[model samples]
Target chain A: MTTQTANIATTRTGFGAYVLALTVGVALLTVSGMAQATVLHDAAHDQRHAMAFPCH
Target chain B: MSKNLLSSAVFAGLIAGSVAALLQFLFVIPLLLEGELYETGARLHFLSDGMTQSEKGTPGLGGEWDRHIMTVVFNVISYTGYALVLVAAMGFAKAQRGLELSANSGLIWGLCGFIAVQLAPAVGLPPELPGTPAAELAPRQVWWLSTIIATAVGLSLIAFARTGLWQIAGGILILLPHLIGAPHLDTYFGVAPPELSAEFVTQSLGMAAIGWSVMGYFAGYFLSRSED
Candidate 1:
């Protein structure tokens, strides 16, 4: 591959990974936010509080 | 992501998460347990034997080994998740802007992360103790999300934007969330005393700031070292 081709490939891969990371981060946070008052919610309870996400 | 970058992030996450966990165990957990005492009516602030008092209840952490383990697991996962986002952003910035990511810059990055994720939203929504009453969840969540995104973008512009106009725009974005205001109940109803709640909020934010600083340091250190 030419150097330009390699650069394009690298950029594409990086963009893909960045999107994946962002999606995962958003999903994790949403799950935590929408979690009902259950053990799973409790597991993340302190963190939610510490992060100041407005849990009652 | 490159293997080295991924590995560095994992290593940083593990170490940073562990440090945060240990600090939480030492400093924050006790306050939580104490707050729970108020939540469960296990402890009262001002009442004598002759005076009327609510019946005591089991402490929150009592016979809850599974819950404790879950907290540890959750914390590690949370930090790792945060590290993933931070490292990814770091990579994108470097690739797009030719910005440098070194251990020194990591500290600032981590602080920015803490500000974007914790402090900015917190300005509107301070940490709450267990059993504290709050507004409906959905709206609060929306406001919180917007606050984080706005603050992150705003801070980035303030730091990275070359021109004064862009910097002013960033400042506006930072304040926009607060300008809209966080959802809150008309009435304040807190089972825990104001003092305990105040202490909990202070300690919680303090501990988190430390954790983010350490995580940023390690992430930058490892990423730069890996490059070398």
Candidate 2:
């Protein structure tokens, strides 16, 4: 049972899953933090300022 | 495996992001509304024209429900995204270094997050009020991105490296971007008063500190729970 559980744990902590989390997280953050479209900028203006992202 | 990771990110992001949004409503938005007036020429500071009208600071929400709603939405998304990144990194640390993830460890991660994401890059590009002058967008963004990347790598080394040489390399990484310097306008100028600008910087960082810390806490909490 312990070995079975360890296998499960290791599979969940595997490289592929972590990479997916990182890639998606980074993509979302870029949208929220660095997107430059005027509409997106307008929507996120206060947030940009608050996050200290470069803003005009 | 991915399911567990995704669930943890989603739940933690939602709760922590809401907390961050509430804090923004309480502190960040009013000052922002006031600053917007300066941006639009509704209010003027350092009066070059010698006009004598008092600043009409935003004392209320002013019925701009749409804008406020947008602010709340954006705050949630931003903080959630931050949580995802932090939790993913924690997962890596757990796998590679045998580090434990828990609420307490998450707080330290949160501090590191704030330092890497906001505080470090901010040394070159401090938070700007709406009307504050800044360098051209592209260069500033480039500098900002590089600075955060360097700081994150440097911080990881400092936190996890076993050797003095590796840690020293990390130290150099942290300083490298600042040494390169952030792109800035050749001359300093702005439409907002210096005092308001300074307060914005302070309050913005404070709010961010709160946001990142909470996000880190929950990210650790949820990820650990899901793994078990």
Candidate 3:
């Protein structure tokens, strides 16, 4: 019982987990936002297809 | 030189981000799909269909799955930003004394942080997308209430589950900007549909809260175990 409790308790110790998680979080925001923004801008580039002109 | 503080923050951030993302996928996404909030809420329908319509580009569930994956990816990324801030806090808090790293306290602080940063912004801020005329002006109250509760609860889990002084500090720091409020630029183009805005804001806060909570929980978990 004591060993189990100790193991469980140990899980919450130290600062390594926190910093690692922080880095992952920051990376996700920076990288993914850029990726999505790039995709959006490319779609809006207006060169994908020629606009059909209206004939009066 | 114990790397306890720095290491803990990183681990906690990932755990929190994952947990928050899962919660979002499970409860929040379903709510968003089924809720009347989007139907009645302000929404933005972009003229150019962006990544949201990728399914049309590729055949079958690939597009559907891709979008889901994107949601998880984006959610995690946002949390990552929050985590960086928490890391700085841990380093600072480690230098100080008298700060208790109790799980319960962390949760309370996490919840308060969510309210300060996310909810407070809604008071004067207009919805981002377009929606039905009625909802455009007065959205369903569920928009605010549901989001607030979801976010508070999600973040509290992380805070309450963790253990450490620095962990506690990191948790609070993660939430600081939202609590004090982020800088905003007025006169932005496009707004969310009424139904979706409520859902999106709630989801945004929920994701953020959980991300911070993860930082707290893991920080506490690792710090308690590390040899001091």
Candidate 4:
């Protein structure tokens, strides 16, 4: 990784977009990583196991 | 978000998630199938007479067509989510710290992500297998998330900090979650053989490392390409 030191205000991809991406990303993770519904758990059982999420 | 950013993230995620699911299908699922049998009492590792049973039956890819599809779908979605966070992080690293990550360096970024999300947290809560008795789900999830966050923040600080004091603080952050400890049941027990359980954890982590590194390369590739 190299360093460019571009000003945030005039950056290539604005900081707001990165924040937005972060928000949407975390939401998806919450669904896959933390949802507790039985249907959800059953569907994601193998994935939960593979990803090492805590499961019943 | 730029169209380029979104598309790049999606593309990277699709490839990464697919690779992860493939690895699970090939190496991890068979063990899981075997472990599940032990979980359901369909197979017993320890006989009542104290004579250890070596093996009863091979794990099957039974005709659970629907369920299998769901597993595949979830794996893809999960990695896509992970890729979004990763690429956006690289973007943040550039915007805030002036770190420019090219496709090549993305491998290191990916490894850092693996450590923060998998390896570091696993120190406290090792990857669990089917039928392994565990503590309450809620507390374990909380600890897991805390460990991931602390490790991620700590690593970036160490990587970006210019001074020794800041680096030491980063080390402490990485250690904080383990020091507190993962929540666990009072008694240690598992229906699956200890050997089987250990393999599941090792293979899962190994697969994740590869998946993350590939995703990081693509994410960085697209992100840099998008800027051109």
Error of 1 at B23 (Å): 1.0
Query: All candidates' lDDT scores?
Result: 0.76, 0.81, 0.43, 0.83
Sorted by DockQ (best first), the order is 2, 4, 1, 3
Which tens-of-lDDT digit does each residue in B105-205 have in candidate 1? 99999999999988888788888877788898788888988998999999989988989999999999999999999999999877776777788788888
Better of 3 and 4 by DockQ: 4
In Å, residue B193's CA in model 1 sits off its true spot by 1.3
Winner on TM-score (1 vs 2): 2
List DockQ for all candidates: 0.43, 0.66, 0.12, 0.48
lDDT (tens digit, per residue) of candidate 4 on B162-214: 89899999999999998899998889778777788888899989998998988
Q: Please estimate how well model 2 matches the true structure, expressed as its whole-model Cα lDDT.
A: 0.81
The alpha-carbon lDDT assigned to residue B228 of candidate 3 equals: 35
Cα lDDT of model 2 by residue, A8-54, tens digit: 76555668887888888888888887888899988888778878878
The C-alpha RMSD in Å for every predicted model, in order, reads 4.0, 2.3, 13.0, 3.9
Interface RMSD of 2: 1.8
| TM-scores, each model vs. reference | 0.86, 0.92, 0.47, 0.92
- Give stretches of model 4 more than 4 Å off: A1-10
Q: Relative to the unseen true structure, what is the C-alpha lDDT of residue B204 in candidate 2, on a scale of 0 to 100?
A: 83
